[model samples]
Target: MTKTEQFSKLLREMEECGEDEQKQKIEEMKELINEMNTDDFRHVFTKEQFNKFEKMIEEKKISLENAALLLKHVGYCKKLKNIWIDGLKESLLNKRLELIIIAEDEKKKDEKNENLLIDLCECYISLSRGFPPELLSICVPHLLKKALMKGKNEEIQKEVEIVLLALSNIDHYGVNQALYLDEIKEIIQHHQEHHNLTQLAYQSAWLFLSYRLFFNDKSFKEVVANELHFVREAKRELVELTRQVDWMKKEENRGKKEEKELYIFFGWFSSIGNFLINCDLWNEEFAGLICSITRLLRVAKDNYRDIRRWFISILKTAAQKGAAKVDDLLKGGAVEAVLEEILQPAIDGMTEEDCFIFFLNISERLNEKEEDEKEEEERKAAKMEIFEKLEKEGYEDAIFSFHEKLPKAVFHPSFMFVPKNLSDYLMHL
Candidate 1:
């Protein structure tokens, strides 16, 4: 028989095989497909034939191994890969493939189908960059549903990650249209109910939402206001995560679990902070959030260096919420907490840039307060109080000492506009 006939016979045999013979037939099909070159394979399987196999796979008439083998073969041929992706998009749009499958046999079907979904998701992700908007329109909702589905199987978990990663790459406008704020809120709420799923849900939510903010100016402010409820939920989650971190810190045998939890907490906190800053969505509640984060700075001192760095970065970003906001942060004692860390006699693990940025924020806030204050006496008194506080913390000595240790690059001419005294000190260093 010719190659086409042989392949057709193999498929028939595979379909006819009983449970005991299915595995062997799947292996034979995979081996035969592996032996064919792209051109010969493409010549044998027309679009009609390809769709037939796809239908068989979707209908559970073929094993996943056979389905994967067919997909792998399609990927090997350039023309076929393009056709396959187009076909997948069409199938998704036509509802031929159910993206949101509600399996009655959850465990059994999940075990059997998880890898299949993962493979399909990976294929979609690989081909999705700069995809036509129509394709994204068809694919994104399915991806979102997959991302929000909770499964304990490793393959299912991987499928979730791939779905989120794929969603992150689609056109932000497409993503926003496909995943509206209300839908996102529902996913967040669903995941929040399960403690273990919260981090993954927040991480996925952040990745998906960030693209919207990054791409659309109009969507930015709208999302900030509309998604405030989700943001508040994230803050609550962060508080719970911080409590976990604090508890883990006291344990003698803290390992990857503790470290992972810390990273997740930071991810949620930083993402929310960034979203707020990016959209200029500052409010009194955010000021309160900054104050709370500042309290955690001293607590993080004895923890990992990364934890300390992340806390400082969060504070630094919070400080950048303009002059009045910075003043609020300072009034909430952010400066003292930050300065205590910066003025340490022995520098341990913190970077010079973090220290400089913290100080620069303080200086800017001081200058801004001076500029905003109409009365000279009030400005002078405010400046004197800040200076006295700094002096009490040995700020002058710390600046001179840290200046000498800083690299010449830190004093680049680009920074010549820094306050004259600070610039002069850096120059002398």
Candidate 2:
């Protein structure tokens, strides 16, 4: 038999060997391939044959325990590492080996092995292209949530975070749909009662928001609302707890600090605000929620200036976008009052040049309120000039002319200057 035939024979025989016999056969095949003159071996085996042999070897090693053993006398695990590192192409068929290495705690005991597991997870995630949506939908979230729930050690936690970040990058609704509300609820519940994962709590809340928004399923909105309520309650509980903590009280007395946990509620409230605002849906509870958020911002201002500003910005944006829903809040004039307070700090905090630019923006916004026709005409003229300039620069038919298309209304000088012919005006477009 030719060398190619011999490789094929070994692969065929591999199925009959016991785990040890299979390893021996694999080693024998490797030795035959290694010992042969490189040029002659290359000349004998076609590229396709070589690829098939490599794929077979990779599958055989990865499935060692699953397949019935052919030869009972040879060692398999000894050859497994070399086959993994050297024999197989880093293809999807060989990806299972990575899962095997990372499956058990013992295999991952060594730091280097742990690192390798992380690297392989990352590599598989990165290189997995042409992966069908159905598979990705089932697989990615399963792996991510599994890692997050199961990974307790610091190293494993870090690895799990990396996997989640990778999953987040896929940017598809199907990916988010794969996760159930129950899973998210469990995570939130555990984090809330345990106090062990407050940081993760915040991260997961934002991630859940992203998941819901991108998925755009209304059913999840109620779930989001419930999550928001839980988070809000947690925040209140934290603040009350902090007030009781001795060190926190001492710092408060010295005017040296305030409770940091207060901002957790702020974060949660902002997300809740978004959910309420976007659906154009509101209830008495939501109204009270915003009011409480506004009060919280006012209280947290001295200690957390940045967060205070951010909360106010969220309110302003909501009032602007959800104008009808926010009419009551605007009537309360919380935004206008807060803006006045923010104005000086926002301006005073800026460099001279930035302040000047900011002042100009303020002037523009202030100017927008005046319903002066002259200013409007001037702005229109300026806009027309810009449009004309753009049109002249080869933007064909960039501007449509209402006047040109419509017939001119004749002034009969009899009654008002209104057109006698109605169709003339109607054809303006």
Candidate 3:
């Protein structure tokens, strides 16, 4: 039977039984689920059906609604909401019910509920030990300070990791909407006090800078500008730690973990390049930051392409935003040398789709510049004018034939090269 049908059958069996029989049915269903070879469909239940099951589990009913809820909850259920609070009182709670609802709090960002789905899965760390475990080992005091400043749930390490990962992934605009400055500032302050947390502080500071640029806010420019020292410090630390990979593994030193070091390095370096360009701090520092980016790309051994893409993006963004400052970087031949030497090689090595995406990045930068120069109202009028002209030529021609010619002059200079074909086509039209 299908997973849902099996689940429905089990729910019917469980509900029809006495207390003793219910245990037997539950055991039998567990065995059945374990035995099922569902390699093609990893989920035992789909998301919608799982939610149905979650609601039914609470009501202890045997209906379509209950079976449906069971399916949804079982499919998507990662953690139970506020289960940590309950674990404090009842130590013998069922492991399955201990699931926390990983749904993003709509009130957290004042956005629509559907706009933010369950962004991450957080396995509950029991709170019965009196208070939430110290996250300092995983997250620095500065990170804790900032994550909690908005009264977010930093008590859970997985949740904090999710937020940090989110901060890294989301666009500048999204981060601004999601995170508060008060939280960011507090986190930076926390990092300032911690000696071993220089990397953490830099990443937080960099993210803050990125968030600022995304929103076009100048207030955090000073904070980002002042962080060049920390960026350098963090980079140095990363190099030192990575160099001692063997020693760290032998000593089992957690501080020298490769993943942590690479991310911290990336977080700070990308931030520095982004901040310098955004804050308009154009000079040797900006040049040095770009060079640092190039260096990272050279030494890149990480499996994650996102990290590499961001590194290149920082260069493109710096060039786009710091257009004024780039005259000097270009004059020294660094710009041409890097692109021809570094970026092109990377592009050539990438998959066809990746090459297309890289081209799109360049195209977007050019398009965005053009877009900024045009008046929004004028563009709308131009669009309407094109439609009107097309209507005069007949709506079908406008839609299929005339629209294709709009960008032919600019996009295809080769149109001039094919003079005979163009003449014949134009004559036919």
Ranking by lDDT: 1, 2, 3
Clashing pairs in 1: none
Residues 167-284 of candidate 3 have per-residue lDDT tens digits of 3432343333233455655555554554323344345444544645645654455454554343344445545544543322322333324445555556655555555465664344
Model 3, residue 120: C-alpha shift (Å): 11
What is the C-alpha lDDT profile of model 2 across 73-139, one tens digit per residue? 1111111111112222234333453343346223424533443343444333332334445445444
Instruction: Show the lowest summed lDDT stretch of 10 residues, model 1.
Output: 76-85
RMSD of each: 11.7, 19.5, 15.9
Local accuracy of candidate 1 as per-residue lDDT tens digits, 1-429? 766677788778777776558667756665665555445565555655656766776677776555654554344232212222334444431233334222311346536565455455445443324555544554555556666677656676655654554454343454544445566656565655653343544565665675566556755555554554434565566666667775426545665466457546655665665565566654555555666666666666664556666767666666553412554565667667767777655555445566666666555544543444455455455556656666664666666565556654553333445544563433222
Which is the leading candidate under TM-score?
A: 1
Least accurate 10 contiguous residues by lDDT in model 3: 76-85
Find the number of clashing residue pairs for candidate 3.
Answer: 22
Off-target runs (Cα >4 Å) in candidate 2 are 1-139, 147-176, 190-196, 226-277, 299-305, 320-324, 327-333, 336-339, 342-429
* Cα-lDDT of candidate 2: 0.42
The C-alpha stretches of model 1 lying farther than 4 A from their native spots are: 1-119, 122-138, 147-182, 189-197, 225-231, 246-256, 321-324, 345-350, 369-385, 411-414, 423-429
